[model samples]
Each structure stands twice: as structure tokens, then as C-alpha cells.
Target: MRPGELVPIRDDAAPRVVERIALVRAAGAVPLVGDPRWSASHWQQVQDAASRAEPDPQIAWAAVTSGSSGRPRIVLRTAASWSSSFPVIADLLEAGPDDAVALPAPAVSSLTQFSLAHAAEGGPRPLLPRGRALVAQDFAEATVLHGTPQALRALLDAEGSPRLRAALVGGSHLDPALRARAEAAGIRVVAYYGAAELSYVAADHGSGLALLPGVEADVRDGELWVRSAYVAARYLDGPLRRDGEWIASGDRATLRDGRVHLLGRMDDAILSASATIVPEEVEAQLRTLPGVRDAAVVGLPHRTLGALVAAVIEPDPDAAPSLDDLRGAAAAVLAPAHRPRRWFMGPLPRTASGKPARAQIVREIQTGEWVRLV
Candidate 1:
């Protein structure tokens, strides 16, 4: 498809999804997919951006980011970029022609759209349910399930877990306890680390996530750099920092024994009292503490320290651990400055893709929307 030709898919119906896929793959047209819940002005902005997008003959599909951090941008991907991973992923899932793939998320999400395209390639077509609420009976004939960690948890919470051949969980970090519980229910959990610009970087079946086949990964300084055939060409409004074939992923990681252990995003570091703190590292320790159901950590403005570490936690129903208890639990794992000075207890706000909305949570805490528990 030529540049400046964009097809916006605003509908989530099955027919519309099928038609859009055909246009992109069969007819060689670039299809732009965005969240249907977006406001009219947002759609207008997308249209304007699409019109101004430069032509790339290799571009096959375009998708908007979830905008959890800020305004979303359009990313362009080629057919070969994604298609190369479909066979490998399908092999991992043991998907066959008669086996159905259940996609609970809307087609607007890049993750869901990729699953749909993967299914269309020689596997059974994916089942797009109306809402995120999925039941075991909904995918009785399906063998593979794909969605965010939060969505999968909700489905399992609502309806007892279904025995599936494989469940692909991404879009957010998967807690170890959650993965254990899902596996206990007879589902093979396959967790992956990826971005909107990079389709599939690394995946973990049971062990830690290793770089996928045909992908090269390295840690430059602390940021993860990935080079693969699956990376998108470019973003419509922003530039992807590139060093030849390698793209700098903003995520921080450490390579040990040929495996990538994600630390957190480089941009999420908080400079407090001359000490650098990664909120995700603190949050991981917080999740391991007793009575903590979920946690989110963010930096708030401080007079002397520039920024103060703050945390929002959701306590277990029958066990509300106090601030002192939280500190005691994390005392062995985290540094004094890494611990949260201000703490709030409640459910953490999340984006459409189920990632903790860190910016929004910080805003609420600063505006006093969430009462300080500590």
C-alpha cells in the first residue's frame, strides 16, 4: 500500500475486523486501528496524523499506543515484521487449524490486532468477545488465550480457570503468585515482554524470558536494545532511536546467564536525596510483603529532596498491613530511600491495557484524591 492511504477501523464487530485484515494483507493497504472509546477530537488528531504520515511501501499495519503515559502515537509495522513470529508463537502455543484462539481484548489494541493477524495465518480465526469478561465456556473449543495480566486475572476470578493449551499474558508485568495460581489451575502460562513498536522481543514459558529466535538483544548502559526483523519501521509522530538495526527500548534490564531480567523503565527513575530509586523495584518488593494485594509506586514533589517516593497499595481483604508493617517487611530488600515515605491503601488505577497508570496515580496523590495512609 502507498503512503497517505489510511483505513481507520473504528468498529469492533467481527465483520469489520475480518474486512480490515483482508484490506491490510490481501489488498496491500495500511489499516489504522484505534480505541473506539476515543473522543471525536482524538479521532480527528489520528486522521490528521495519518494524512501527514510519510509513505512506506513496506508498511502493512498502523496502530496507536495505549497512551498510558501520555498522548498516543501511531506506529507503522510491515507484514514480515509480525508474520515472522507467528509460526514460532503458534508452535509454542501448539495451535492448529481446528484450534481456536480467544482474544478478549478489542481489536484496537496492538496486541489483540497482532493475535488476530496471527490467527488468520493458517490457524483458526480468533474469537473476539464483546467485553473483557471471558468465561471458560466462551472458549470451549479454543486452545490458546491472549490478553493482559489484569484481564486474565479478572476472567479467572469471575469464572474458575479453564484448562487451555496455553495462555499468552503480556501488556504488563505478571506477578509470580498470579502465574503460579494460573498454572495450578491447569493452564500453561507463557509470559512475553514486548512493546507497541516491537512486536515480540522475548518470551518465557516457565523459565525466565529469553530472547526469541531470530532476535538479538544487548544491554547498552542499562537500557535494553533489541534488533530483529519484527520491529516496526517508524512512528507517525515520534522518532524511534535507532543504531543501525538495533532499537533502544526505554526499559532497563540486566543480562545474566543469557537471560534478560527487566529492572524497570529508565524514565521511571526517581532522584531522591541523591539516591536513584526505581519504583518498579520497590513495588516488586512491596508485592512480596504480607497483606499486599497490588502496589504502585511513584515519585512526588518534595521541597528538599526534589522528589519523594510514594506508594499506593491494595491490601488483602482480611489483612491490612500498616505502614510500619510494610516497612518491616521490605526492610531487608529495599534501601531506606527506596521505601515509600507516603503510602495510600486502595486499588491502583490502570490503563486500558491493564498497566498501572503511574502518571495518573501520581496526579491523584498530589491532588489529594487518594488519602495518605502513612
Candidate 2:
């Protein structure tokens, strides 16, 4: 580890993640999670960026993009940027000594890595589920689970966390049905909206997504621009760049009554029937429909309309919704352009962090891999 250098720390052991972070910071190198899933070329390109860029001793850790939209790149931020939000997180989660916070692969997720770091500073006891498959027995000792909506659903599918009391959810929309399932299991849920570039933007404790402490938000040109100490300083090799002290997230949102309502990512917007449709608005509507476990709305190539609104559904194992069922339900809520014309039901394509892989789904649909419904 040297000045402006990146040290790849690859480990699944929860306890050691903090030690690795500390060691890298002490040695004047940026701590970067060496996810095995990342290609050698991508890793090398990030390393090259670190080697070329001027080093900042304050920059504590680095995380790569989730690749939900495009190529992954390094996001640099200070250790204090995350630690500053620990109290807010602690207040939000209330992880007691008796509570064990369960999360998956730390080597791939900065969220998990940050959770482990938080644990190191006396948050909650971080626990790795017993085996590869997150079964009920794996979370037998756990009281709280930290993950995205997709990860939570996977845990629920694996016979559920019987003893779990709370879930800290993020990364995507939390469907009403999913929330109801957790509530039925006696597990309380708290969700927050954020990006790797902008740390903790707004959190939904109970009501809606209110801006987190030390964050100032503004909706500019339909995108949320955040000014916060928690924002990452730079991107190693990506299109997104910070403007001064503020970083603009690609999320299309509206800040009203001091709460943020996310529409969708600008990349996920569908241009259909001469209208721009935000996929999240459609996906959120679809998730409320019966028999849908989760959903991803994407824009597929269309001959006349330029792009047609399409949907890929992750159906519940017990029951799957038909094309007509979804369409009929969507008619009441979504505008014609926002309504998905092509429908496909199956397991959704997700990134390493469990966010919908919209670009991947579009490609799958284009290649005739995901069969469209009438």
C-alpha cells in the first residue's frame, strides 16, 4: 500500500473486513473490495485509474459500480463519510447486543462492507449465514437482516427467518406485498434511498423518504442533486462526476413536503408512444399486483414507437400472474405510455448487489431469451 494506490482486499470473513479497511487506510492506500465476480480487465482498469490519479489520504475506501446500467467503475470516499452516518443507522436499526445482523458476501458489496465496519465500531454483531444458500437455520440466531428488497425476498423464499425481528432494506423499491409478508412474520422493516456516489440521501423510517442528517437535496433537471459530507469524492473510470460539493444521482425524483419520491433512474426511463415513461412508476404498480414476487420494467426496441414499455417479472412460487391480470390491474394506475406492452414472467436479472439489471433484461428480450406474452 502506497500513496494514491489501491489495495484489493478480498475476504468473506465478516470480522476481518474492518481490519482490512483500517490496514489499508493506515498504509496510505485506498481499500478496494476485490470482488471475484469482477473481470480481470475491469479490475486492472480501476487499478490503473488509481495509479494515475492523485492520492488523497482522506479518501478511505473505494467501491465499484454495481453494473446495473453499464460498466463498473471505482467510487472513492473518505472513511468519515460512512462513519458519520453510523449514528443515523444505529438510530434507524437499533441493533442491540442480543441482535445479530445477517448480511451476505462482503467481498462483493460495499453495503455489507460498510455494515461490517459499523459493527467494528459497536453497531451490531455481524453474522454470515451458515452456507451458500440462505436457509432458515442460517438465520436462526439472527434478529436483524440488512439487504436490498431482492435479498430479503430470497431469504423469505428459503423458509424465512423465523426469529428475525427487523430488516434494513435498500437499493430498490419495497413492494407493499413484500412489506406485508415481513410484517406478517413479525419483522419490522426500514428502507432508505441512496447511491454509491451519494451516501445516505433520504430514508423512509415509517412515513416517506425524508432527507438524512447532514444532507441537502435539490431536484435539478428532474434528477436529484445532493450536497452532503457523505458524498463520494470521485469516480475512477465512469461517466458520473461530482459537481463541486454536490453529486447528482441519476434517479428521477421529486422532493415534496420535505420527502423524496423516486420515479426511477434516468437510464431506466422508457420512451414509448412519443412519451417518456419512468419504469419505476410502472414497476411499482406491477409489484402491487397479485402473484408477482418482484418486477423489472425496461424499454424494448419497437418499430413505430421507437421503444416499447416492457416488463420482466419474478413470479411468486405459489402463484404467477398472467399477462392479462397485470395489464388489467395496470390500466387503473399507469398511463398508456407507462403501461408495459410486452410482458415476460421469470426470475429477474439482478446485479451483484441485487438491483434489477435493466440493461441485461433489455438485451435478453432483444435476443428472444425472455419470451413476450400476448
The best candidate by TM-score is 1
What's the distance in Å from true for residue 108, model 1?
A: 1.2
TM-scores of all models?
A: 0.70, 0.67
Task: Tell me the spans in candidate 2 whose CA falls farther than 4 Å from its real position.
Answer: 11-28, 50-54, 68-71, 96-98, 129-132, 237-243, 269-374
Task: Give lDDT tens digits, candidate 1, residues 174-227.
Answer: 777778877887778899988888788999887899888988899999999999
Best by lDDT: 1
**Runs of candidate 1 exceeding 4 Å displacement:** 1-4, 68-71, 131-137, 160-163, 269-374
At residue 277, candidate 1 shows an lDDT of: 68
Give me candidate 2's TM-score against the actual structure. Answer: 0.67
lDDT of 2 by residue, 141-175 (tens): 77888887766777787855677888888765677
TM-score: model 1 vs. ground truth = 0.70
Clash pairs (backbone) in predicted model 1? none
| lDDT for each candidate structure | 0.75, 0.73
